[model samples]
Target: MNKLFKLVRHLTMSLFAMATLIGTTANAERLLTENFEYELGNLYSQGGWLKYGTQAAGPVQVTNNALTYPDYQDKAVGKAVHLTQVASGEDLMRAVSETAISSGKVYLSALVKVNAVADDQYFLAFIQPTSAGIVDKKTPPENTRLIASKGSVDGKFVFKISRNSATLFESTEEFELGKTYLVVMSYEFKEGTKNDVVQLWVNPAVASTEPKPNAAINSATHTGADMKSFQAIELRQGSSATKVGPEVIVDAIRVGTAWTDLFDVASTEPTMTVTPTVVYDGSAVAIGSSTTFATYAVEYANLENPIDVYLTGANRNQFEVSAETIPAGSGKATITLTYKPQAIGKHTARINFESTVSTLNTGFAATGIAWDPENPPMIVAHSEGLTPFTCKAGEQQKQTITVTTSDLPDYGKAAVKGLSNGAFIISTATLLKNGNTQINITFKPLVPGDYEEVIEFSGIKATTETIRITGTATENGTTEDREGDRLPLDDSKP
Candidate 1:
């Protein structure tokens, strides 16, 4: 006991010094335990030990140093919880093993303090029983028995479960063969309201009667084949069944290993977010790496649900993304996202870049479009899908005419008439030019009829078409007037 105390104090001082040396800087240490392995992690659990159950109500805790449990009673003789009164679902618990072991009589010893009470609740136990076998507080197998009221040890319940069964072939009991148990304080692990899984180690007997040990199951992988121990634990019973009630607190759980006890919850790397917002028209964009780039999955979702866009498609980062880790932190690379316009006129695209790093969020852009109309242009009007225009013609009337045109080579002389036979016309078209002005006309007939006047466009493009003016007027008297710019038809002269 003297040697053990000295050793623990030394280890604690060493660890605290190391922590102090680190100050606020980052550091990494590789240690492995039973349930978890870092593939890559840096998790740390602090303090001395964890008590799976709480220190409240049922399975009530006494001021005694060691937490004791009897099955709750039909009623309480005192506040000390007995097995029966503890209610249906409470189970007493404590941490069984920190790291796994390979071999021996697994000893679960605790400095227990008990009061002068005699009942079935007095048996020392383990919430998570060892693979050897399960021993209920009520039934003590051969070699094991319940000790009566020596409970007041140095004025507190400080007791221990000495050892588990020694030989594998023999009837099994819980703890390991060679290991020792030394619990100094009381603490609790309050992750959840669930009852803890624990194993109880009673007072160990003398050496000569010690059970045999299995070579492989007695130790750790580093020690020998028997060096590895499988210390997996689970609840023997819940708050309800089998008698023991809840409400117990155990602390300072320490197990023996070839090496000193190491507490770690460390992970390899911290998560980060990288946003490369590029404005590229004739330029290039990429997710470059000065080191191995964390392959974060980028999302693009203007169309529907957000989609994943990789570093390869950097130009379009517009959706949700999953982050990838860059382990070594050195080999950087870049991913490029590109977008090119197909047509003109207000081309719009929306993009969003989301990352686990909360700081780099919302990448957006609103750019201007540069469009030039004609180098060798076609000046055709844009497709007006459906246009409404007024026509002097009656509704639902059909008319026909033959039309031809000459592509106008000269503007000063009557030139190409771009209009076709289907073109609309004005009241008159006798091309009359004065100064730089030329006359152009258009008209819509109310109904199909025989009608005529003149059609011309001087110094401009024109098309000639044969018309069947119907009003029953044939070869109607007509005259050409080199006349004034206001020439109306001279029907009176005729």
Candidate 2:
């Protein structure tokens, strides 16, 4: 009797993941919509539903205790099925429909109120055989696609999608307690690499009492093989089958061919929105050097799901994208462009964003300037004669040093190094560019001592220039005794 009980338990759990829905309704076929009005004493086994496990271990039943408040209770259309798994073993309560979805595209709609979620649970549309036996969760049958599921982690609700034994996508939105969510999953599968598509939308029709559903969320083309046919819709829990699992209420389940038939509101076509149609490099790009032109946006309107926009055209190679797969309901994504010229001349390139819905291209302009090897630009400036400072033994005094450059296209970076041992320090160095360039260097004292340093400018087309910095600090004393106590504003003035 003990061995027989374990075999039944394993075989019962393996019955899920099979069966298909076929034949289409001219309008929308309501595949299965159950609002349990009758008692559910043995409903899990008798109502065209085949389940795993006994009533003593666990059972799925309809109850009024699942929803009692006025808000969700009225919308529930009376009693709802409470799905639970109390056994320490695998437990599943699933119904295999007579019809199978033969089409590559289909829609699934369900109204679910999450009472509690422990770890992971399945509210799935998948393709699996109706054979008897138990299948391990780690190694489910081949082509077992979990089209959609509702789960929770760390006290937040989550939507999960799995295909070919791997997770394809998960939603970031968290569900609220006692609130009902109308989840709609729409999918179109195609054979190829990253061609199958999946999308999830929550709460299409907002009841007068409940809040709106989360915006649409979609996944990138799954990286695996295309799913077979839609076989079954299941509400199965994972290892959450223990007594610590969840108490969920499922109602108003529907499957159809068209979005209009499944959802109260009709689906809208996807629209593409691109920002800053033109991109230009602020200054002329040097030949053999690259300059970033602009950072712009590509957005979606009316479409709640995520999709990929393939980039194309002449200058597409010059641009680099951050991410091609825009997340679902993100509404917008960003792209950055860089101009790297090979030859010296004026150039223009058109780059385009192409997706299933729309294609948008923008023209970016760049001017390449060649370097003049013979007459290189030079930095011109007068160095400070000497910098002097007087302060307390541990106090610090700030000094400023400036460098000016003539109009030139070529520029070099400025660097300052101190010669004193932990006595002289460079606080800040700022380079400002107008028609000319001005570099400001500030030095601060660290201790009572005499110090000297040098500022070096290198990498210019012309010869490098070095400026000397000298300072002296003494004990804090009377003002009259400090002759050269402060650093001069402009030492070169005298």
Candidate 3:
């Protein structure tokens, strides 16, 4: 009787083991693995991964395994990988997974962050759908799909999901068993997107449980990386394919079960219908005190047109406080936004803001923010006095965009229209440290006909500055070339 019972127990154990193996195989698809260590090693460690050299490559300062950007705040607007000065390098890995995928499909993802900008172009390679390997050189978009979108014309990063698909997942890239590509790329998005925000979450797996968002938002959660190099991981036999070669790094190499569920996102991210983040300052604008002759207005613009964002401001009524000066400890100027006579108890009114940043004699209008007195105060723009030089019947010259805050009562952000013409190209719109934001308006007449370059500045008020220049196939003229009557207001009045 004892022998029979033992035999039965042995059989049951074998059956259970078989079941466990089958279950394990079934659950093996939802994983992400790699050979690259996640670390901040010097050149000796990080290899191949690109760098968006900020002050330096990061692995910024860390304590207790925490990493943070020390000097990450920048105004450039391009999304790039920030390299802290001391940053020797970073860890980027390729594929390796927990279970073997016979059908050869895998779900892949990674952690992404935007320092002060968005990404231009970034990709991830899932190699040899049948075996484990890496795709070294970048393949063309026709050959590989893009899993992420770069920054748009405005500025910001976006990650959305579609039905059974994600926001920006491409399938052009192949998938190899046990192999994953550790890509280092940045991403951004257009501004004015409704309900837009950014954050980080450590447990990516847990993010899927949240309520269904419009689409699959990759950034639903992201946990910043720990500041140390991850250690190499142990793998099962055959894990290292028959061919083993090349310098590779690995850290915190955790194994996962990768299940291919056909994450269907379009071939590319959307075109970005929103604006950029150039207009959000998170604070009300403060106008400065009015100097005697310098008049104040709810709107002010530069003298030239062609430029959209005119050098303008809000809060007219004429304000009088501590002249124009940045508040102590603040990196930006803190002029008084108080322009209303009723601005009494509040000590100061919360109004007025920079519309156009005039520099290089050009009007750099804010991207998009219509004026609103009640909701969020805004200003209008108009043209200034001086514009670009132009041509006449046979004389030749170029048009320009200049700011004219040199005098008051005649100032507001300058808004130039119809200047995006084929003839006038914007060369430089230099905005010095609170200097004249000049826009070098380069005008090239298309034909031999007489052309009138009307540089109109419009914001709160409207003014038109016209320059007539003739186009000819032959180029013969110097800065001294002239033809029609010259407007003393500007030398380009041909």
Candidate 4:
């Protein structure tokens, strides 16, 4: 009975250990992954990707048609984030995640393809965030705790971990130019000095049946502010000289608790579908004038085998096609189409969608209005002079001039001049009941002199009118002197 009891106890202990191992393996989770499989042309950010770069650095290009890396040549793995400086060596390009991480021993990995590597070129593949919003490389925030960077320094590839403006760890491994490499970084957050740890693995063999980091090229533990969490990350690249313009392509980026999840690839071909057949409003557009239509969206099914959706239309120049490529796992994408009337008469175009398996021909119609500036309405004066042309100089005098036209005012401006020491005001410049535009001009004289003014009426595409005015200002009363002595205006007194 004692031997049987011992055997039972041994079996129970073995079973418990196996269960614990299995549970540990199942607990691993992926925190974030960005494959760049979607076509986000001209978009600054999507799916929480916020691009950051040096003051004049070009934005990162998210594309899926790169053939530089043959290993990821297919669309499934072909999509990548292309980063390059704008011919300025001092420029940096980076795309940071909107999500923030505060705690955990997180693993970050990505497949990076260096199209051209030059001397003194630095590329920071993963950045541990310290604060929210945008993280600028030129002036990193004070809370910035750590950064993992690699580059070709002194004609050799080097990996480094930096903390609080200090280099914590660096690797001596060398990398080749125009080559694809898998990089993995593990960051363990802890409180107090010498408690936080960071490790890096280059060309990690995570895709193999037995997945693991190739080898730890660099590792370090440093003391700083309590290492609590990271708010964002970025893939940054820059150079030290204006002549060295290097381009880096990255794909299959993953952040998780373990390195195994970084190998996740698209497994199926998505089904494509567009809904409701976008139809722009059928309206008349004026020639040399533009109108914008409402925005619309396109929907598709997520698939493993990536497909390209091309939006083409007849008379492409007249219409602007703005759309983002449907990502590998996204079910919907929005497209904004704008049409500008180029010529007069009816304009018809077919906006067609071409995909791997289907095509949608969207019919659009618009009418263009012919606008001739030379035929625009003209402005004419009701009469030549003011109603009352004469006024007393010493006593303020007023006159009314009625101007009529059949055109809209040109920026609400009617130039009036030749009123010397006199004031003029337009009480009204509006259309009358008979379809004619009437402008009421009032002029007041202040000093005795021949007052004259030219009023011009102008409008868009309309022949304007220029009118001349004549006015006289006389003394309010006359004083006469018989023998060097002035007399009052009353003739009797004189």
Residue 248, candidate 3: C-alpha displacement in angstroms: 22
Clashes of 1: 113
lDDT of 4 by residue, 317-426 (tens): 55565653446555677655666655433444444443333222233332222233433445566665555467676555455555554433223346775455444555
TM-score of 3: 0.22
RMSD for each model, in Å, please? 22.9, 25.1, 31.8, 21.5
TM-score of each: 0.22, 0.38, 0.22, 0.40
Worst 10 residues of 4 by lDDT: 140-149
Q: Which stretches of candidate 1 lie over 4 Å from their true place?
A: 1-249, 252-264, 269-494
The best candidate by TM-score is 4
**What are the lDDT scores of the predictions, listed in order?**
0.28, 0.51, 0.28, 0.51
Report the C-alpha lDDT of model 2 over 58-94, residue by residue, as the tens digit.
4566677434333223454656676664544333434
What digit string (tens of lDDT, one per residue) describes model 1 on residues 1-494?
25796467546646754664565343322222222211221111211122234323333223223232231112222122222233343333324445433332233322222222221232333233344423222221211111222233332222221112221211113322212222211111222322211223243231212232211121121221111233422111123344442122222223322112222222222233335645444211111211111222333212221222232222222212233222323223233433332222222343434332222334444222222222111111111232223233343223222122222222223222424233344433332222232223333334444333333343222233222222222222335456558756978878
Query: Which candidate, 2 or 3, would have the higher TM-score against the true structure?
Result: 2
lDDT of 4: 0.51
